[model samples]
Target: MRRLLLVTCSALGLLALLPVNGALAVELPVRKAGLWEMKVLSGGSVPEMTMQQCTDETTDKDMSTAMSPVAKEICSKQDIQKTATGYVTDSVCGVAGMTIKSKAEINGDFNSAYTVKTSSHTEGGMGGAPRDSSSTIEAKWIGACKSDQKPGDIMMPGGMKMNINDMQKLKALIPKQPAK
Candidate 1:
């Protein structure tokens, strides 16, 4: 359960990371307010996952406001540059005693659809050995959220819907591990 929460938190961190250069932090453009479906593809131990998110501008901005400070505190290097193809971000951050160096290229406009390809190498981390991974995240605007859903609500895999802001509720969703 702890591991799952850690993974969740890490994923949230990645979603909001932006370039920080000597206090000149550039805010990433907010996604269109509504429902967005995201599919993550990877060849690592983790399998492909899909989720839908209901978001508003303020919720998205709040995530950035809440996370950037933590990123700046732990990351010695974080850079982003605009490219002809799209935008590219490079970062080196430490979490849970592991150092992660990554480069990601983002393509497509956020209003409709977008793709982000990321490659990273991790050292001295959870597995206790160096590891490399690559992943692609494709997301698209999926219309409005159901009346029952609220902003920051994410329909995670397995059809569990939880608000990103109420993280404590996530503990109930993670399955327990067997006795080792």
Candidate 2:
């Protein structure tokens, strides 16, 4: 009877050591606000300018000779404008014939939503030479942050969506061991 009781107690202790599989609990980290900024700079060549002028020295000659250079000068400015447009267009998207500088800021509540403010400046070239513009966008997250019980993963939500693939990719990006 004593041996039987000892065996039964040992078995119960071993069973207690075994992990319980159902409904494992995990602790999730609190999300916080983050900020990022991006800037773009671009430039192009200047166009030549032509102006008509009267010349007293050449007054004896036909007035047409003096007037010819002035006409060419005026037309050259137009060609410069066209060339600058072509260069700027090739360099940046949706932004042409001007140099653009922009700034953006975001204030985020990791749990719920975020607000963004952006502003831009453009300059150089003819016809409405320099201008500045600003815009804003607001966004929200769909769900609360959560953790996974699996060996190598954490689950989280971003901007009104739960991206399982992103979570997996993020898991891969994290190093298993710290660098020396």
Candidate 3:
């Protein structure tokens, strides 16, 4: 009878461990390559020149000129949250800011997560000119082993451009295994 009880308890313990092992076995899907779009909604004045000024200015002919102070200020003040969603197949996957190196797969049907980084440097303005500055921003999607493709060209709304290969590499570092 004691032997029977011991065997039963051992069986129960192994049965309990099965679910745990199954849970640990879950694999994350891979990311793929495709087109991704993102938008920034900011609070502040929209930069625009009056019609009269446009007619008078000969040097500044482009409508999409450099960002004005008000525009910059607004962009700085507003919180920026970017959400990326798209499809992935064996041939292609599309996400904003990164090139799909390889196709993403649905390992266990969980959505991937991402991280973003941004930096800017501004030179103090001189002689009433707007401060000279530039910014570099990168966004990385983290989770699972997906695409082998590195992040590549990113397109902004109204046709802006950025490079995000490095960021994608960083995101690729996310471990495929779950914690024990």
Candidate 4:
């Protein structure tokens, strides 16, 4: 369950680049319709993680729909801006009792390859420890989906795979926060 959570969040965060303004709908340019290979380098302690996603236009839309409500509920500020290079996103949200402030810059072409560089600060979480962190997401088109893979399929580390569309079921498993 934890692995799936990590995989899900990582994939969504990477794809959506942490979203901005659910009301406005952070509609990122639909990536080329095909398999995408993504390499993520996050923080210092965790080793680099690589994953593959079979994606399509509809799948990207579905991801935005799925994550928007949660973003709306937890995020106080989410904004995206067009830059000369590409896109820049800034967001602040509360998650699992932590308040996170993040800024990300995206560069490169979506149809071929792209890079997102992000820096963030987190405080007042379950551990009550504050920290600053950054991550780099580098992704490129691979090809069509594999024979065994389908849209929304994410091949995680160690060859484990999960369908993002199926992850809605796990919402019930998350413990809800008590009233403030």
**Candidate of highest TM-score:** 4
Question: Model 3: runs farther than 4 Å from truth?
Answer: 1-35, 47-150, 166-180
Superior by lDDT: candidate 2 or candidate 4:
4
74-179 per-residue lDDT for model 2 (tens digits)? 2111111112111110111111233444444445543454443545455653445666544443444433223322211222112222221233233333223222
User: Residue 28 error for model 4, in Å?
Assistant: 1.4
Question: Model 1, 10: alpha-carbon shift in Å?
Answer: 6.4
TM-score attained by model 4: 0.85
Candidate ranking (lDDT, best to worst): 4, 1, 2, 3
lDDT tens digits, residue span 42-139, model 3: 12332211100101122111111221221222121212221234222121111121111122211221222321112222222222332221111112
Off by over 4 Å in 1: 1-16, 19-25, 167-180
lDDT assessment of candidate 2: 0.28
- lDDT tens readout by residue for model 4, 121-176: 87986669987878888999988989998999999899888897876665454445
TM-score, cand. 3 vs. native: 0.20
Higher-lDDT candidate among 1 and 3?
A: 1
Clashes of 3: 16
Report the number of clashing residue pairs per model: 0, 2, 16, 0
Best by lDDT: 4
Candidate 1 residue-wise lDDT at 4: 63
